[model samples]
Target: MPSHVAPTTAEVYRAHLADASTSSDVFAAGLAEEPAAALVNALAGLDDPPTVRLLVTETVAKWLRRDFHLASTAADLLAAETLSLRVADGSFANQMVVTADAVASILSTDEQTAGPATDDPEFVDSMRERCSEAWETAEPFDLRTPPRSRVYETLGDEIDPAVEADYQAMLDAVETTRSNGYRTTDDDRFDEVELVLLAGAKHELQHYDLSRWGEDVGLASKATFSRTKNRLEDQGLLTTEKVPIDIGRPRQRLVLDDRLRDVEAGDLPEAGRDVIDSATE
Candidate 1:
């Protein structure tokens, strides 16, 4: 579920899909109009991408490469998981939606998969009629998806290439440079909290998701993770803000401080540091 209260985001998205005529163009445009709806539709039968990404230990982005089959052997799905880690926000959601739409479109007219199995009695019956010659003469495609370099690169194959390229060029390349450029625990052997903060600073947006790093630091339990975070807050090393979504519970985003970006572990006074104050509350 996207949240505990609301239906999973995918359910809301599936509702929207009802109005959409299984067309890729409609989906592409719908994505532009309602990104959230697409986000919901993306994980489709799955749960909220954001919450799942934050909760799951480290599952691959099976939705990204449109590889829903958990037992897939295609390299694209593996590559998509790697890409998920690098892209900001929810790029994987888009990949899922696009791939599903494409598959639906292809399947609707496919012969082998369409025959008597479907009540329509049209299993790609038109495939030979439509592309027999084209199939024989068709050139082999590079067989690739868009890259992550730009929106066009991510969406080139799915949408009108010209439209994507036109919009892509106009996007401003703003650099989100923090004054605390090298914010880290400067050679200090840090406890879980300090280490988590350091790792967050290295992230693209500096937002820490516990599921992504909890096990690595031995803070797999949310209660412990929260306590550690609170300890860091007491030290003024991190700040947190909650983002409310329609589905699941609001997510608390952890922001590391730039001023104290690089604190030498040994330089700090180790006086009374073991107190935990309501980090999980």
Candidate 2:
């Protein structure tokens, strides 16, 4: 049987199950992915399974979008999830909180770069609760909508400087970009989920990968993801190649082609419902 914490997203599961024996022998074959064994055990012990699963699902998706979606493979994201999984048990949680300056250091930034790691206990605790949920359910989260961190409630009216600055910048950028006739997938004025998928795939450092784009921009059902991806591929916005790290596998990594980038930059929803409609057909 597939492990409880393994990805339940149809795309991932369908990809894994291409071979009939892949499902039953996944663990023995060393193919068990994130929410690994320990994390699942921890979540299985939690009082509320559904809510915890939802939280972790959102966090994992957001973390992937923010940090790991650019990875050549799923390895980096999986590694981060493994470390964050430590919150499954109280002793480990206490140790991490007491010994570490940031109680939820693992929740935010990854190993390489420095960023504002969360210190708020309530936020961290909420992360822990979400982590428990991810381990329990093991599904991909829709990252189109970001979850609130509750930092404002924890620290009175004043927002964290980083957050405050970001809020102002976003507001300013909206006016500037809107006036300049620039619109992005994140702007919410567009309908094609593909635009949001593209935005999520892009990294701050001019990097991108399409490993989880379909799931993160998901709607209605997994079939929609597959169909949309297929149409986008046909439109020459998405291409595929052998995995750079695991070249022997049947898996083909999705690449962002120049066509989509050009379209995204040229006009705001100029492609219109026709782009999405053709995909549905």
Candidate 3:
């Protein structure tokens, strides 16, 4: 028989959340601030589109129910910690504490291996009580909006059908980029919003007015998108043209520059890095 292969830490946690039979109230402890952040980034950056949406949506729903919590020794990390909690539901339904090493496994990009886990009732109860006490003294923090769900809720109500279709198309393009192995959190230069703009510019094969695209994505403010777009242009990766409109000032239509014109939708991340690298040299 083939040697037993362990499910990845991500796979383990995702399964726990998907199992309705598991306990709803979940607690995680022992993850350091850095690894905790990486875990969230990895979940958000998963290659499968449906899995990405499912994990984000499930984790956020649990968090909203007050059924999920993370404890850390670093009080200053709470704000960022809460964001990670929004991304991960729990490792095991019964276990309240996870080792830092296990978290590192979750963040690993290599062949995913299972981390240590347990379902012992007494052990879980003890850990849960300990974590609850710790949480009482922990600094207060509020959960941020779940990144993936916020996209849908933000764009759910477009009055113009054509505009709504375009928004969906751009979002699809972004997913395509993800499938192509571009991770927003992994890339220091371009964030999720920036990737959306670049991928949209390339794959959509049409120009979107900057403000409108930002409003539709709902991930960042229009002003943020404007700033990011300007930065990308400065780096020679993007260009914009003014389009005549029926009202107000001419709209700026986002376009990928010559460097990115030939890049396939899936090859964006690599191509983007090359352009950004060449510009700085």
* TM-score winner: 3
TM-score of each: 0.24, 0.24, 0.54
Q: State the lDDT of candidate 1 residue by residue for 1-281, as single tens digits.
A: 11111234334344333433332222221122223223423433332122111111112222322311111212232234321211122222222122221212211122221101111224323322222332233332221222223323433443334423433322211111111212232322233234434344323122335433344322235565666666566656567778777997787766645543343332222211222212222
- Model 3, 210: alpha-carbon shift in Å? 4.2
| Off by more than 4 A, model 3 | 1-8, 11-21, 33-123, 136-140, 143-146, 149-188, 203-210, 213-217
Order by lDDT, highest first: 3, 1, 2
Global CA lDDT computed for model 2: 0.30
**Model number with the top lDDT:** 3
lDDT of 3 by residue, 147-247 (tens): 44434334344323333444444444432221122333234444555666675565332344435645655444677677767777777778887878898
What are the root-mean-square deviations of the candidates from the true structure over C-alphas? 20.6, 20.2, 10.0
The full ranking of all candidates by TM-score, starting with the best, is 3, 1, 2
List per-prediction Cα lDDT, in the order shown.
0.31, 0.30, 0.44
TM-score of 2: 0.24
